[model samples]
Target: MTYFILQFLNGLQIGAIYALVALGYTMVYGIIKLINFAHGEIMMTAAYFIYFFMTLLDLPYFLAVILAIVFSVVLGVLIERIAYRRLRNASRLSALITAIAVSLFLQTLYAILFTPDPRAFPLTASSFPVLEIGEITLSSWTLITIVVAVIVMILLQLFVTRHKAGKAMLVVSEDLKGAYLMGIKVDRIVSMTFAIGSALAAIAAALYIVSYPQITPYMGALPGIKAFIAAVLGGIGLIPGAMLGGFLLGLVETMTRAYIPSSVAQLSEGIVFVILILVLLLKPAGLLGKSEREKV
Candidate 1:
């Protein structure tokens, strides 16, 4: 029972990080209908920014986080304006290829700059207090991560539901032409969406690095892929669904890792895709997504 509880807490901690990154995936898909494969690269970029800020500049943690967020937001907007905006009306395949190109570009740039060497993350490497519940123990950072994930999700929900800019986003998401007809600034809103998503990725990168403490150019790829899967599981465009999917994916992956045979433990990540396949077969619209009937 204690072991089970500990695993559950671990799942939640990992899931929170997934939730943060998944939200970025969902939001971008919601607004632009583009996958933005480079989204993960942006997270990787943010992690590098944090690493430099902390290691070279010796800035405070919070300040480093803020700077990373700023850089990510700017980079996201730039990517949208330069790479994706012109291709919005083009074939989906075209946009997808471009996204891949952008991702490779970032990866190559980082490889040249950082040389693919994994550097230790300074924060969360030192000893921190651990919390004990019954016989189960949890890291303080894990608890902080869970709380932070919940708070960020709640704030995001409120922003989308209650704020004026958010409503404009909703309108644009529902119908781009309708939003333009209704006098909403479609382009600006799209840019805002990218900025917001990128900022969230930045935050996710920060939280994730603390737990894993190892940074490299390719670090964000797996998490980014998993987060995209989570978003799809929960309904790609739905904010609440992204959160739910993230947590669920985290729990499932953790459980698989703990319970699977040692010889096959290396295949834990593969199980996630298997689960995705089952979910898609059972619920084509996703757990939270609605099925649409195309007009013939």
Candidate 2:
């Protein structure tokens, strides 16, 4: 029971990270209809920024975190402006290729500057006091992560449903042309989407380092991919769907690794892919997604 509880906590922590990244994927896809494949690289860049600020600049942890997030937001905006904006009216294939190119460019740049070696970041003490519940012990960090994720989700929900800017974003997502005609600044909204997504990725990266300090240029790829999968599983353009998908994916993956045989564990990724395919075939719009019917 204790072991089970521990694994559950671990899954929750990982799910929190996935939710953060997946939200980025879902949001961008919702408004722009682009995957933003380079998003993982944005996360990698943020992690590296945190590393540099903490180790080289010797900044305090909070300051480093803030700076890293700021840098990531700027980078995301620049990527959208330089690569995506130009391709806005272009074919989806062209935009996808651009996204892939951006991903490759960032990876290459990081490799050159940070080297291919995995560097470990400094882990500060866990944020929460440990609590013992019968045979199960829960760490403060895990609780904090879950709580924070929930709070963020609530705030985001309110923003989208109630806030003017968020409603504008929704309008843009629903009908870009109509929204533009209605005096909504489509470009600014799209940029805001990128900024928010990147900021979330930064937060995820920072929290991830707390548990797993090792940082590498390619580290973001797997998590980013998984988060993308989560977005799809939950209903790609839906914000709440992304969060639900992330936690479910995390829980499923962690449980499989814990109980399944080592051979099966090795094939867990493949299983996830299969699940993704099945989900697509069964419900193209995803679990919570609504199918957008085209009007002639």
Candidate 3:
């Protein structure tokens, strides 16, 4: 029981990271309906930017974070403007292929520039490094990650539902044509979505490397894919649903590793897909997603 509780807590931490990345996936999907497969590369690029700012220039952590986020936001907006904007009315396949191309381009570009080698990322530990409750131990990073994820999700929800820009985003997501007809700047809204989503991924990348400190050009690929799964599992276009899916997926992965046989423990990643399949079969719209009626 003690072991189980420990694993569960760890899972929550992992889920929090997934929630951050998954929120990006859901947000972009909600607006404009593109998956932005290149998002992971955006995060990767931010990580490198942070690293460069910290090491090469020896800047303060706070400044480095801000600059890294700015760089990521600019890159995201540029990708939308340069690669995806024109394809808005084209087939989904075109957008998908473009996203893939963007992903490969970044991966290769960074690999060539940075040599594809994994670099060590430095992280500061919490003031209270460990928390103990009757035999279960939790690290500060684990606790912080969960708390941050929750706070970020709450803020995001408020931004979407209450803020003026948020309403514009919702309007655009609901009906781009209607939003345009209503005098809302649909292009700006879409750009804002990409920028915000990319910035969130940068934050996630920062939190993620603390747990797994190795940084590489391809680092964001796995987390990005997992987060995409999480978004789908939680109902792709729903904000709260993304959070729920991330936490649930985290619990599933952690629990599976703890209980499954050691020899096949590697299959834990595969199990997430199995859960996804089941969810699709049972509720195609996702756990919190509602079915939408489209004109034929």
Candidate 4:
């Protein structure tokens, strides 16, 4: 039981990071109906920004984080304006392919510039003090991660329901033409969505480095994919769903590794995909998602 509780707590920490990233994925999708596959790459770029600010420029840690997040926000907006804007009226296939192209471009560009080797992240778990409770021991980073995620979730909910700009986002998400007709400045709202989402990704990248510490050009791929799965599992367009999905995915992965046979433990990743498949087959609309029909 003690062992189980430890794993559960560990899972919550992992889930918090996943939830942050998944929120970005879902937010972008909710507003623009685009998957923004480059989101993981955006996160990777932010991580690199932190590396450059800290290692190369010798800036303070919190300062580096703020600047990195700002840069990520700008990068996201630029991508939307340059890459995805024109494709708004195009077929979904076109937008999807462009998103994939953008993702590849970022990865390749990073690889060429930074090399394919992994570098040690400056701010790691060792940087934090550990906290022990009874027989269970955990890092301060774990508590911080969970607290941050919960705070973010609450703030996001409030923003969406109460803030004027957030209400504009909701309107645009529901009916773009209608919102525009009502003078909502749909383009601005879309950019805001990307900016907000990218900021969340930056935060996730910072938190993730503390746990994993290894930074590579391709570091964001696995986590990005998992977060996307989480978004889909929780209902891609629903904020609460993303949080739920992230926590569920994290628990499932941790528990599988802990309880499953050692020989087959390597299949834990595959089991995640299986969960995605099951979610799709069993509840295509997702746990918190409502089904909608469109006239074609």
TM-score per candidate, chains pooled: 0.98, 0.95, 0.96, 0.98
Candidate 2: which pairs clash? none
Model 1 misplaced stretches (Cα beyond 4 Å): none
Compared with the true structure, the alpha-carbon lDDT of candidate 4 equals 0.91
Candidate 4, residues 9-93, lDDT tens digits: the string is 8899889889899999998898788888999998999999998899999998789989999999999999999999999999999
lDDT of each: 0.91, 0.89, 0.89, 0.91
- Model 3 segments more than 4 A misplaced: 124-128
Residue-by-residue lDDT tens digits, candidate 3, 13-42: 999989988988998999889998998888
For candidate 3, report its TM-score.
0.96
Report the Cα lDDT for candidate 3.
Answer: 0.89
> Which runs in model 4 stand beyond 4 Å of their true positions?
none
lDDT of 2 by residue, 109-153 (tens): 899987989998886425547878798777777877778777877
* Residue 208 lDDT (model 1): 92
Better of 3 and 4 by TM-score: 4
lDDT of 1 by residue, 1-296 (tens): 88888899889988998999999889889888999899999999999999999999999988999999999999999999999999999999999999999999999899999999999998882356888877777788888888988998899999999999998988888888889999999999999999999999999998899999999999988898999999999998888898999999999999999989999887886988997898889996789999889656
